[model samples]
Target: MYDRLHHFYQHALALDNTPAPDKLTLHFPNDRPRKLVLDKSKLSQAEIALLNTLFHTNVAVHHQVTQENEWLYEWLINGHSPPKHKLERLTPPPLRCIHFSIKGELNEIDAFIEAIKNVFPSVTNLLWKSRTEGVLLQHLPEDTVEEELSVESIIDTLATDFLIQTSFFIGSPIDSSHLLYERFKWETTLYDAVKMTFRKKSFFYEQEIVTYYLLHHIPESTLKLVSTMLDSVMNDRELIHSIKTYLECNMNTSLAAKKMYVHRNTLQYRVDKFIEKTAIDIKQFANAAAVYLLILRLEAK
Candidate 1:
């Protein structure tokens, strides 16, 4: 008798069955030794088939007992409730969203989240409301340096330490309750933009897409000026590739040097020569933005 009850309990757990909180004792007809319960009917169809086949006797499953507190019963009758995280409940001001997508083992996903929390302790919320993809983090900026640290350093660490393929789409900071959804839309736009355009980057910002946006919208006369600005290096594929790579790497000599498989000094010399010929200081964001658009313009031409 004890073994039978134990098996039933195990089956219930395995099926994720939710029985009524207020359980009632069962009394079978014809004075049978084994008792049948109404709650067993809540078991899924597969479990019911198994029970009927295993017991070799028809269990009385037609009985439905009415309870006064139907609301609580309804709640329990649904599948087990999922544990909620802190992010599921909070909405705060001045939040920056970082949308992360992972492509590795499940443990890696948890490790990645922990790593982000450790690196950016200002993360106010870590959410997984959607079933489709990765976690969305709500980062509260403390200062300018901390805000910058959240994006670049996180990307570097995720790449250098974890070796897991990932992409982080960052949205601008927002303070108003009404503007929170705007931030989410921006994050999604950046995510799709990164996937489509900047496949090699570990993370990307919505602001970076402005260069491409300009390429599509700028007038032809303006594009000609852009082309004229970059024409000196346009025909030189090696120099062009080097300069583009340097700009893409945020003008970091060491990183660009490593990427180009050239020494730091050598990469610097190439960058200086490219700047001297083009008359554009690629180190400055404005000049880089121009050169970036010019590159796209030339490509389109």
Candidate 2:
């Protein structure tokens, strides 16, 4: 919808000179440098009134589209996909989306986005829905989703330079633009699930927590059992960190200790204490799965 209009407007602007007609340009309120060019002379009275309502009286134009689920407003502005109507009909190239939420001032958010664009020059689209939240959709070769794109170094620089907390949720690559809308929704779900638990972290890949994908829907009885299992270390931040690191390191005490900058003996003691208190040997597959889901549940609470 907007693309066709944009091209047409550009053509009209090229052919005409000044004092030709009233031109209305609607600038999107985001980091992306894009806007809609409306030739007022080409619009009917009704159309003009509608634009007024959309841009002025009723709501903020950028936010309006985000609130409407069916509208692919962000993608359209960032040139990730065409208008919603046409995008649904055409098959687009494989693209991946990384949804991000940055907590900071407007300037900090802008700096972070600029840094991202500088790092990933091939980034297909970087769309900001608001002052501090947006999605970055990029084109990548098929089956290379896991290999490409490391946001750790970029995030570390941004965190240190800008003094902000930033997090990202990377969704799987999809072949069609039509699937992006649903994929974006899934990214949002994953982001919300990890936000509280991983506040100090940089990013979370959807594949990393596949087992806890439905953590929010787990039955209360099961959740309670998990809560009970880890009740002793419920409020112990250090102990909880030890367990999380140990599990993430695949039950390797030496590696986990190295990552935590602690001695192996200290790490083993913490792991043993956790087992003694919970009586749930995290070394076991089933017990590990339960504890993993329990961690998500606890953080969500």
Candidate maximizing TM-score: 2
For model 2, what is the alpha-carbon lDDT of residue 259? 99
After aligning candidate 2 to the native by TM-score, how far in Å is the CA of 30 from where it should be? Answer: 22
Tens-digit lDDT track for model 2 on 1-301? 4565567556443222211114345555442745575555566667656665665321232442334432455343322345647565433568777777777764644466568767664465566544456677677756554445678876777778887767777778788776776677556556655564545556777687444446655777877765777777888989988998898888898999999999999999998998998888999978877786677567666
- Give the per-residue lDDT of model 1 (tens digit) for 158-222: 77777756667666777763455445644554464445444555565657655544454567887
Checking candidate 2 for backbone clashes, the offending pairs are: none
Model 1, TM vs. native: 0.47
Candidate 2 lDDT score at position 49: 67
Q: How close is every model to the real structure, measured as TM-score? A: 0.47, 0.62
Best by lDDT: 2
Error of 1 at 217 (Å): 8.8
